[model samples]
Target chain A: MDATERPVADLPAQRDGQEVIHLDRVEKVFEVRRRAGLLRREKREVRAVDGLSFSVGRGEVVGFVGPNGAGKSTTIKMLTGILTPSAGTLRVAGVEPARDRARLARRIGVVFGQRTTLWWDLPLLDSYQLIHRMYRVPDARYRENLDRCVELLGLGDLLDVPVRQLSLGQRMRGDIAAALLHDPEVLYLDEPTIGLDVVSKANVRHFLADLNAERGTTVLLTTHDLTDIEQLCRRVMVIDHGRLMYDGEVAGLHRIAEVERTLVVDLATEMAPIALESARTVKVEGPRQWLAFPAGQPAAPIVAEIAAGWPLVDLSLREPDIEDVISLMYAGRSAG
Target chain B: MAHGPGRAALYAAVAAKGFRRYATYRAATLAGIFTNTVFGVILAQTYLALWAERPGLGGYDQAQALTFVWIGQSLHMAVAAMGGGSEEELMERIRSGDIAVDLYRPVDLQLWWLAQDAGRACFQLFARGALPLAFGALVFDLALPASPGTWIAFLTAVALGLLVSFGIRYLVALSAFWLLDGAGVGQLAWLVGMFFSGMMLPLNVFPGLLGEVARVLPWSSILQLPADVLLGVHTGTGLLGVYAFQLAWAAALLAAGRALQSLATRRVVVQGG
Candidate 1:
């Protein structure tokens, strides 16, 4: 019980190379009663997570990608013990999340991109201090983590600022730092790069990469951004309609679907669609055109040709989303 | 209990953060203080007129009635037994699925909320309660406890009363787990608390069985019991009995709240997904 005095080394050692997150036939069914009419009520069971099963080893950065209402949020909630599973076994860091939520909370950290866990009215530092006490992070460890988060997340200037006043990027960074302050062994990130600019997204990705490398922090990242998956995760799991659609390498999923990458180009003038050798024009508006190129093909040549032939104002590449891949996978299966 | 000091330190820190959170709303606090003071004056005048007509009605003189008015005003915000506070925020969180963040913490959910509520009540006791009481005493010659010991007992009663209030509100807040929207329940609780907490009128003044029933209900601890203690109505062993009564209700309500919380957590529906 002397957790304060007992050093990390003095604690019971974990099993060597154990699976940090494990799920077997996990299912969550929600009973929703909607007003069918003026008086009649309809009771239906929604299988949010249907027999989902996966296991991640220590230090694995696995990306869990899905479209909206694809059971990613439900799975995350169950993993964090915010909601209990209707059936099946789920464990994180050797503890059942729903049964021993508080015990597991000491070892796992969670971040939701859409919502902040920080105190809305308090300064960023105050929230961190409260977290420090809440988690019982030792004084020295708390200082060390705070200093590291400040340095790495560029939160030095933002510490004294109230969280409500921070920009989205700054607040997102603050949230990431707050979750990591407790030095949890496993980190669950839900849409970590959902709504961030290119620079902030890159910074977050870089920080997460370094964190995994430096601390061996096992990360379960659920995101819509393919680039986030491509950059940070080697193994990615794709879920659709509450079921596992694909589970393997990120590159394999892209290749199997033969998904097209979109190149949105803004032309200088409202001219006819520019025909290209490698890319096909999908849609065209006044002064703007969307080009579809094979996911495997390089966009550099297409960009070079377009830039040389047409008066190009500005252009950006949109990576194929997980939803695109999942839909394409279904399309491929049906076509075959 | 084994992690006594560490757990205490964590909840104390949380309580301190809760206090600082309320302190940030400087303008709101000032507005609240002003509103409580005005209500105190209005209620005092009404009580003065009634006590004058009745002449020591319900074992209270005019001065004692005035004191009850100010005390009730002070406690309305401090105890917040009539609802509308963090409980509403908690309900909103449940509806918005933001309670996920709260559930992620390692601490006991019920105790964490209790600590936070305690912090808010303690701050309101001074920031919004004391001033109205001072104003009533200055303007209306309210009943004052002569002994320092009685003041200490009164403060203790107030603390216990806060626990009772928190317990009741917590139960109402957790109803959001099943109801999804606790607004209706919150209003009902507020109406019941207002009628029984001796806020609208002292429970002692209630006629017949209504007074007996209101005096024994948990709401009485929020205002009536504490007010009675301060007025020297409950003395010696009688005072201890009043405290014991408050303690029992607080314990019972809090335990019931804890039970409901566990039940709610078991089947959490986290609205968004």
Candidate 2:
């Protein structure tokens, strides 16, 4: 009955504990069309993921941070069997995602932000019920999971309401619950916090943190939100332009890139771009503008001066969180 | 695929529950009804005009042609009735790579989708298709059949037509796996089916060699064959053969559907994040 000693291949499609995901030299290349003119055409291949590989340990919460086209989703897709890899080996819950996709389905859970896995026209409760059956949760187990999800997500009132009627925050909560209903060993959350109000976003972060600690679920979270990486994952995977930039601790990301941080001033009046004592505004717009600073800076003084500026309507300090660091890494990638 | 109640029933339950949940989209269903009725009028008008000059084109009388147009409206709403033939949702899933979760679920993907689609289509048929058909009948001096046998034959033909349409749409959806623009693929499929599937006109009415080719393809079955049956043109053993062919074609398309699904899944290439 123990899961540890099972043959890597005999790895039951459903994994509950330890080493939920493993990947070796995984790559994903996409073929895109480039038309120059009415007559001219070109076929270009984008290396969305290039020979990038890493494994998610049991109960490990890994952050998949990337820019817009960074290969975060690609990595998750390859891991989950939604897309076949151009090259390399990928495994989750002891099954090869590509070949054993169906078997893997029962063992892993997934949530996509901005998209409800729940039926749009149906009640949230009904969507949960559907997921319960879709994953073949035992009746008793389904109840247990459902109860937990409702309690955790505070979905009591919204459960009976149709998905279309619910707010985005409510829908997201419902989506999270639906993914967890199956009790999969690994949960792939793609931008699960996108567009959520800060409070709702916090709730999801907290819930995810708790979910991993309590259930020992290997959670691979992909997001542009740096706070997600900071709050959830100690291990981080950075992908850019369809290639793995770095795979290591979250701290290593800032070190890998000359992290670019920006400070914006909501100026009361217009002014030309000014060079900062410590850094420069890489690029600037009119009065309401941005000033780029080296990753590590004494932000307190800068904010204080800005707050004291006569024309400054509002002033806020920003740092390169996960998105900035990952983008820099991506922009620095070696071309194929 | 799994025999156990836990998984198979779970999928069915989810699909059923999801379908029930979708029933709440009264607004959507209502909108569909309005659109379908408008389209039905257009179809009915065309049918009425086509048979006006000819005494019988493929056995269609004045009344029967109207029936065919009405039935086509119903089938268009029915084939993927609820949500079965949505290439857009599929494309979004693919783009976001959310389809990974879908691929993992322990159920027949096609069946699960087909069931949900049925929910939408069924709602449209009642809310939009049937209502439009009735309105068309009332407004236009369309013929009503004299015998119950005509009704039975018509029903059989309409059902067959539904199967054929569903198969064709599903085939079109498979194009999303590879196509950069899923909508383009879907549009192409719609355009081809519209021209050849007899959505616009009976295959017999086509001016030249195109008409001959149209008959060979199942597109004609979407509207033409059902209309033919409704008009009471196919008599005696011919009826049996036509019904048999319809069923046979459905079975063949079902096989093709399975094949396309497998092929598309295999072709999935998770692109850049």
Candidate 3:
């Protein structure tokens, strides 16, 4: 059926044990208003997440990467049962989140780097304890989990400090600790490394990498940090303008960009001119020039010809990196 | 399955911790206290000026009239105003996906709110609303309840009346599921409650069917019942009956709020910001 034809009566998402998060043609639209003054009004709908359908396997670390406002947060909110989707079906932890949001809260832990979930004025430990009780973690299990978190996150020193008094880095640790107090099966992190210093960012990434490996906890992290994608997630999904544009292994992204190989050369003569066809000029600097082969073009013959014909001094070849690949992907869609 | 004292205790701990949260809070509570007093004084002076030398108006003497103003002013900040914030808080949380954390609580969300609210309600009564009321009475040299029994009954009536008021506010706040922001509706809800609860004046003075309507509505319980106790017009059987009605209203609102929350959660799309 067409998206608009999907009835609202379609039940909340249902899941079995293996699948932790699922979005079946899920779409979200926000009804907004533009005022022409005070009384006059215009209604508009913003499609933050278009018909998205995917599922997260247990213990899988999936990197959900997108440009800012490409509907990353909206997708996470729907998965975790925070906002109701305008269309499609969504399920998390054996239930539809939008349908039974409160019920799903126990199984999921969500953290947004821009906002701390811990109570602002309370000590970090107190806030965690409150969450511990809130999620009804058993006394012994709560203590065990907390002790591990504080130790793992190195939060012992900051536990007594109120959330507001803690530094941004300290607060992030506390927020992570608070979210984990219940030991949720899935952890949804939104821009967890945003704006952090290098050392802190590394510590967070290391902790996250370790957490995913040790617990086999399913992690769905949405971040703009390419390094995070490279470090932790094997599979990266890219979305832009509310649509899923790419879903594959990191290496597939690299291969797509690897189609073009760059050749850099230095001119032996000051007035030397290099001419080439079936190739593209990418960069020129000082006495060096770089040209790219269109995927199937032979680099060895082209280089031999350049060396024989032009006053080429030396040459080197390199493949495109992850940044180049993803940028190309984003750049492709933004054009049309 | 139900809200019990244990849940209230947890919520109270949350609230007590929240009470100390005052130090960081924008001096908002202190300002709120001042507003409470200002509102009380306005009602008192307005009535006193109109009454002139007359001892009573509409079957209420100076003490009764003054008590009504104090209770209404005190309640405006405590139970009623505290819950009014729920709508915006709920909307923001839902939009941000930060709400995921709140969902996991083993405690029922409604009960959780009840506990947290109990804390806020207590803080407002003691720090923001009631303390100012005490000072206002002293500053204005207002008549006091003469008997110890009257004070006891007044506290009971205040507590019961507050439960009713809290229930009504929570129900209004739950509208966030349908309306993006329920603050305007919540505020309007309280004002509507004020109309029937006699916050503006004695309900008896409203006349005809309106008075009968006010007598049965939850609004009258906000202040009128407590004021009646303070003036020594209510007690014993009458006090218990008022408490029963308050408890009933609280239960009804709870049922309705939970049903709404469940319905909302089921249909939630929880996607991008």
Candidate 4:
């Protein structure tokens, strides 16, 4: 059949509570040789991803978060069929990724933030044109998608520029647009905000949120930037030492980690650190004092205790940052 | 988008992109032209000096010998450049983990790269092949093919030569999948290719047994056969035999490349960051 003869359906209807991505105890072990002593070598098995099992429902925007070398990238690679799991079952959109990689490629979009998928020497438009042919995107659909991406990503003025010349932020936006030109049902973004400025990060986050909400594109995002998760992912999974440490809502992570929320109290006059039973003062600056209490604890009682004991001119409670929560979780895991 | 361009169109696009990529390196192309031209001059002079003493050596007169020199020079970039160091590019991509992205695409990795090399060879055939031959013809008394048939046969032999060369390079690059570093293998292949393929000197000049062995090897199909056909060294049935040898090697090596590529993909270990 001719390429143009294909139907123009947008997306397959999501089955009720059906998982788009499913992994059952998948494991990936890499055999690496390391220098032992003079001219000797040691063969070691590095279990990059060990016994991981998770399911992402249709249209769910999930964040896969971890510290460096925590198997996050490994998982993404497996999902894209770039790496095959050593053991266990893995499926994406009802297809085994490694076995049906070529077919899976048509249904998924991927972006790796550290390196570009664009042709460095070609203009952005040319890269898109090549991708159009590579993915076999229909002519009319290609134009429509390009127009939408160009306008929405603010890529109109930059389309003629070579990808090598674009700033990190602009190039990243261009990469995102390139991935989506084929209208994939699932988008896998690995560190999509790694090296962007604040404004660019916000822009990427906003675009991703809109993409997930409006298009119902299932997004699996791997990022070091916690703000990316806070803004985009309602469901976040934390992995460390090749194990899932936590998987739930973003707010629920603070409770799992036993993280502390900070309360900064400003006194009318400079005084010694206020003594409060409800909360411990972690830092004291002339007229201002910082207190730490369990994030799960009510801040009202602590505020009342401080007000009763000292001259509480102004006070505010700051929720725990995701970074702090994750580190605390890691620390607790190691200690235990 | 529901459907994309067909496989043939996608391969063509990759080839065109490769052509544009190499075309942008104007300085390198000029330098390559200069280097090939200089080598052609030196080779022509060497052949002239040798012919002055012997008058006719290895059944080639001075003019025919000079023509061989120029043809060898013109085809050098088309064959050697296309054959050389693509292994390094593949190894670099593997080390940088960019191979992951490449594997994720729907295209077959071997065919995609083959198309890219085809584009590069097409450009070099013009920029590096024709210009040097024109320069040699202008400066020296170069012999031309006697008939249209010889020209057509020579062109067909050259095309086969390119396919054989690409096959060899593809195998060398595929080594990176297992060896992790293809430099050593690539260097070794280059040495064997240069000597046996008659890029440096005609295989006919090699001592009796060595020349016979070179004729049977696939590398000879890459340069020597084409050069012989271009200079009208082989005629009639002998010429057909030469074409058959080239086609056989091209087919064999390309099959080997594809088989190796399949094995390599199964055990792809994308290294580093």
* DockQ leader: 1
Instruction: Count backbone overlaps in model 1.
Output: 0
Per-model DockQ against the true two-chain complex? 0.67, 0.47, 0.24, 0.37
Could you tell me the lDDT of residue A264 within candidate 2?
81
DockQ of 1: 0.67
Candidate 3: deviation at residue A205, Å? 0.3
* Candidate 1 runs further than 4 Å off: A1-17, A36-40, A259-261, A271-286, A291-319
Judged by DockQ cut-offs, is candidate 4 incorrect, acceptable, medium or high? acceptable
lDDT of 3 by residue, A218-292 (tens): 789888766677667766788878998887665566554443667888887554346677567677777888888
Between the candidate structures 3 and 4, which one is better when assessed by TM-score? 4
Q: List, residue by residue over A1-336, the lDDT tens digit for candidate 4.
A: 121222223112322356789898999999989999999999999999999998887777888988788888889988988888999999999889988899999899999988788988788898999899888899999999999899889999999998889999999999999999999989999989877876787789888877877787889998876667766776789988788888777677656665577899999989988777778889989899899887546677888878787888997766555566667876877888
Better of 1 and 4 by TM-score: 1
lDDT for model 1, on a 0 to 1 scale? 0.87
**Chain A only, candidate 1, TM-score:** 0.86
Choose 3 or 4, whichever is better by DockQ. Answer: 4
Interface RMSD of 3: 3.6
Q: What TM-score does chain A of each model score against the native chain A?
A: 0.86, 0.76, 0.74, 0.78
Candidate 2 Cα errors over 4 Å, as ranges: A1-17, A31-45, A66-68, A238-320, A323-336, B1-53, B56-58, B79-85, B88-101, B136-153, B182-188, B195-197, B203-213, B231-237, B268-272
Alpha carbon lDDT of each predicted model:
0.87, 0.71, 0.72, 0.82
lDDT of 1 by residue, A1-336 (tens): 111232323212322347788899999898889999999999999998999998887777888988999999999999998889999999898898888888889899999998899999989999998899888898999999999999999999999999999999999999999999999999999988878987898899999988988888989999987778877877789998899988876677767776578999999999999898799999999999999987556678999999999999999989778777778888888988
Q: After superposition, how far is residue A61 of candidate 4 from its true place, in Å?
A: 0.7
Local lDDT at B121 for model 4: 77
lDDT value, candidate 4, whole model: 0.82
